[model samples]
Target: MASFFRSAVSPSSHPSPQQAAAAAVAAAGDAAVKNLSSTFRLPFASLWSQSAAPLSGQRAAAQAAAAAQAAALAHKEAAAAAVHASRQSTYNTLFTILAVVATILITEQVLYRRKKAHLPGPTWTIPIIGKFADSLRPSLEKYQAGWNSGPLSVASVFHIFIVIASSNEHTRRILNSPMYAEPCLVASAKTVLCADNWVFLNGKAHVDYRRGLNTLFTRQALATYLTIQEKIYRSYFAKWLADPSPAPTPYMMHFRDLNMETSLRVFCGDYIPDEGAKQISDSYWLITVALELVNFPFAFPGTKVYKAIQARKLTMKWFEHTARESKKRMAAGEEVTCLTDAWVKAMIDAREGSDKLADESRKVLVRDFTDREIAMVLLSFLFASQDAMSSAVTYLFQHMADRPEILRKVREEQYRIRGADLDAPLTLEQVDDMEYTKMTVKESLRVKPPVIMVPYVARKPFPIDPSYTAPKGSMVIPSFWNSLHDPNVYPEPELLRPERWMEGKDSPAELNPKNYLVFGSGPHYCIGQQYALIHLTAVLGTASVLMNWEHEITPLSEQVE
Candidate 1:
């Protein structure tokens, strides 16, 4: 290996060859070093320059965290703005609702205010308390003022809308439409006459009960009452002349008392003791006063109800006593003389007799009425007759005084009908024969009715006049004055013309048949109408014979008060 190496080295050992090889190797090595240094210097310089503001991963992460925090703050601000906007929107909605509610209340008040403006009433209503002042102090002057306000007007008292039907047709409609109206007899009616009285019955109950009462007013029964009434009138007429006077004082109270006496005697025979009758008559006025058109509808002490209750207690005792006596007498087989006896006897006859209750004609046979029931029925009759008869009596006296010529004719007629025995009990035919007296009574009633208007409640909403519908629960009144005073029917509405009935004219016939609501029109009409007419006729006839009566007319008397 040494020898071969030496041989090879021998050629390399030559100075020229070895030196040229070394120079080439050294030059290549130097060029490589220079390139490496140049690359390294640039990279190192770049690294050194970045090191002045170095960005580490941790620093980048910290910057990112800061940005996230800022974004979260921005989100919180945006959410807060959204919540604030929502709150503002809620407040605006609430404000709008309050405004709307306030507007509705204001509108209702305005409408209510306007409705009361045009009515023919006081200039300024007492705010929400309309007509209460007038209601508390019901004056005749105030009533007339209200009447003359217009043909139709309205008033609100205790929230009761009273529509005054001044015309006869309207009044008739109010009374006749029993389905639409029921009599709200002054507030004291229920108290004076017990609440369970048949007069308070309505609809089918009223009709059925009234049917039973029809027998009591039969032609024969009326004849009996006529005899009793004639006797009572003759006696009372003599008493009127016992203490004589030239000028007439107000006889309204006297007439009312006379009528009450007659009513008690007629209904109860001798059962109502003299003292009891006088007490009942004297104290009855309290009932009248209590039964005012407007009254406090409560039973509290000192109220109308309290006073009426007292009156009822006093009268009911007498009536109940009469019923008990009548029942005992009837049970003992006593002969029937007066209305009570006759009624009691009939009831006994019916109950003992073999009569089918279902047979309408057989039902004409009176059933046994309880003492309380009889008392209530008697009270009903008294209530029905009291005001109306008093009014008729007053008008009769007034008419006789005002028109002396008419009184003379009536006196002549009475003398011709009852000859010299003026004290004799007049028969039904005799009472009927006094045609002029009857005519005068009718004329007087037409001119000045006792009860001006009959009030009825509308049971359902009624279409009264085509222009206006009666609001449900509103009063719809129809007046008889229109029919009685109609110019077309009477020719002279203001004049006291009695020949209208005698002449049988078309106007008279029209007014007489369908339009007259003097005793009411329906099944609920006055049951004592025949007896009432006969009693009035007897009184006037007897007065014509025995006493000369006069009326001191007053401005207030003719007025509404």
Candidate 2:
């Protein structure tokens, strides 16, 4: 880490005062002394002879005192020399350390710049924690400055260099080029998610792992999950209606609770108790806050990361315990009730070679996953969806309420699809038929994207553009805000207009596939995107029909938080 007066000089031409005095004495000599009063010399000679003994004794005493003073001065000079030497040694040591540190920091900066090439960014990075303070308190204005700079830009935090791709082309390139780059999430993700989690896998490993889990989000699987989703939403709405605080309180936390409860039920089902769901939901906020862009790396006590880890541990314990119970139930030939049972049944059928149950594709990679492995996968899904789903739910409500006409259209579609029974659960076909609801959900996500950007690490030099090659081990970020809100793609992108996605005419925005990055693009795109969108659409649709709700605009509510 790149971690902040005396002079005795004289002119050579001038003589010292002692030297000048000696020279004057040598020039005058005895001749000048003889010219004095010789007349008084005879009488003075007798007095001088008598006083000679006493004068010599006084001179000897004076000489002895002068010698003692000279010895003391010499001793002081020796002590001063030792102190000067000690100071010099300390100075030399500090200089060497600073020089070494400076060299390392300079080299790091030079290499960072060299990798950047023609990219738009700082020529030299701030030493150590560059842009850390800004990231700690993120702002749209600062992020906009980067996106506006060029297609690509650079930044660093805590010695980790980051290259940001802000343009649609570059952003898609980074997401598609999985061989050159992989998702790193953030600095502390490994600690929070566990290094062994399947979500951290890359290359063939990541593909294989994801393929097995792909069955969980299949169209058939989502149909089953919807049954659980609507039940929770209904119960929560009644609670909200009964609550004392009906004066337009902040709904962000309420939405978080809704999403968390829905997710837990939809994943674990009856295997996890109501108390278990509430416990997980309450503690899950720690994980959400800990996953911010910049956070303390260590999980020391009292830190957000520590609390998040503890919450993770608690959640995982329940997940693994549920998995074990599900496996036992499956072994006893119990019917599948939830995702855990579904997964365990598939593994069992594949192992036993049940021709009716084992599909040809699943048979190839069919093996029983460990309880811990299943728990980790479930936890990974929760971690990815928790905050993002909450954000999407909140904004969807806010946007719909702010525009009541749109909400009216959405409610019309909902009531028509479900008929007179407002409490009836929706099937996959019912969700698909609600075009306006889907459009509303789509527009809401675009206006307030849950994930602003994603972080990826370069395995090797990544030539995202002709001029710029992200260096090995550099973190590259692809920003989504610009892509989603590109005015050219969606005219007046800031407006929450769902008609842009409707099939009125073949407009450029509706015609362009690239314009829609709500679920991202390419091979590493969101796995459960379908499930997530449908879930939100279902929530908004159901909320429209069941409850009378209104959006209260606050001074700060309109601003992107």
Candidate 3:
């Protein structure tokens, strides 16, 4: 009751108990202040009162700073834990990657050695690079060494598996059985010839397409090509005469150029302008150079593919031009002259009347061929003729030069067939009647065929023989050189004697079809076989009669370029 009465004095009065105690103490302090103020005669009491509130505010601020410091330490600890977890995760990932890489490398090495242990090749391949070093510039001797390794030997480089089929039976099995092997012409084929060309076609499609091409090389067509061949040879022979020296230059390059020019003229006739044909002939070497067994396939500006693509474009343009012109001329009812003309006339004849078959005299389907299709056909002709014809012509000159005695007989035969003025064009019948010249051509091709190997693709797993079965997708190369040069069949295999074919012992045509894989043996054999021989016979016969040449044989003369 007393405390209530005392505290009710005013609304601003302090509370009782502890409040009263504080009030009493404050009253005492006020009294003391008043005393001091009286003694000093100053405003010090007010100054003290003003500083007390500010001191209380500063104390609250100090407490807040302490609390903030504790909170900051907790946050720092949490951040440190997060960083530690991230580092641990990264280390685990790195370890896992390294382990996988090591495992893969070990597996690869083990498998590589295991496969190589039984195969017949170099005792040791050049590490991971394998035979790449030797493959750069392959040699006939090196190939022969590999061929002699075993009847069937395996080689692996850059994961590619190559099986060498050595024996004649094994080779024939590889070529005839197109179910386990395929031709792997260098990496540059896709670049040199477009991917669309029929030469790259495989399986039954390739076989059927090749069948259609046989009509283009019929005896009549071949006869027509021979006339062109004779005319071209006579013209080039006169150019050879301008040299005036008895000694002959390399002549292989000259012969190659002549063959290419003549091929172009025969294929295109006057439809291809002279300047354009010359340009194509000159630039065609780019395509040949890109045809090495191995090459970089990138089409970047400086790559082999890029250069080859440029050559293909040039050739394609001329081929398409020839097709257009031939079509126009054939529509006007002109006589078929060159290959292009013959093809166009056939197409027209098929369109007009009864189904005109491409096979010699047989009329079959009257299908119309596109301009591009015709171009692709011509491309096949060029592919079949270019390298093969060049090699044959070069060897023909070489054999003639080396065997002057044989050359004398050949010249005499040509003179007996054609007069001393050998400038006259040869008829198809006249060319076929030159039995001796034909025998010489056949013998020359047999001794050193322009194409040494025939490549075929396997459609599936093929059981080639009882002991040897080619693995699917492997390049089982069948080299015809062994078969063509067999000792038992030819007796003196290395010797170039045309009389062996002419001797009444065996029908050269029949006994040798199995051995003469020069044009391949099975369904996909060269369609232009007859035309090729006819052209060769005409060139050689004319050259023998008109031109006198010699060979400057180098160590590399007999080697493939």
Candidate number with greatest TM-score:
2
TM per model?
A: 0.74, 0.85, 0.78
What lDDT score belongs to each candidate, Candidate 1 first?
A: 0.73, 0.83, 0.74
Quote the positional error of residue 92 for candidate 1 in Å: 24
- Clashes in predicted model 2: 0
Q: Model 3: residues >4 Å from true position, as ranges?
A: 1-119, 123-128, 244-248, 355-365, 419-421, 454-459, 505-512
* Whole-structure CA lDDT of model 3: 0.74
Which order, best to worst by TM-score? 2, 3, 1
Q: Write the per-residue lDDT of candidate 3 for residues 494-561, one digit (tens) a residue.
A: 89988877777575544756887788765556777787788788888877776677777778777863
Candidate 2, residues 176-239, lDDT tens digits: the string is 8889998888778889889999877877777777776777777777888888898889989989
Off by over 4 Å in 1: 1-125, 136-152, 244-248, 353-367, 505-512, 552-557
Candidate 3 lDDT score at position 167: 70
Q: Measure candidate 3: CA RMSD.
A: 7.7
RMSD of each: 13.2, 17.9, 7.7
List pairs with backbone clashes in candidate 2: none
The positional error of residue 487 in candidate 3, measured at the CA in angstroms, is 1.1
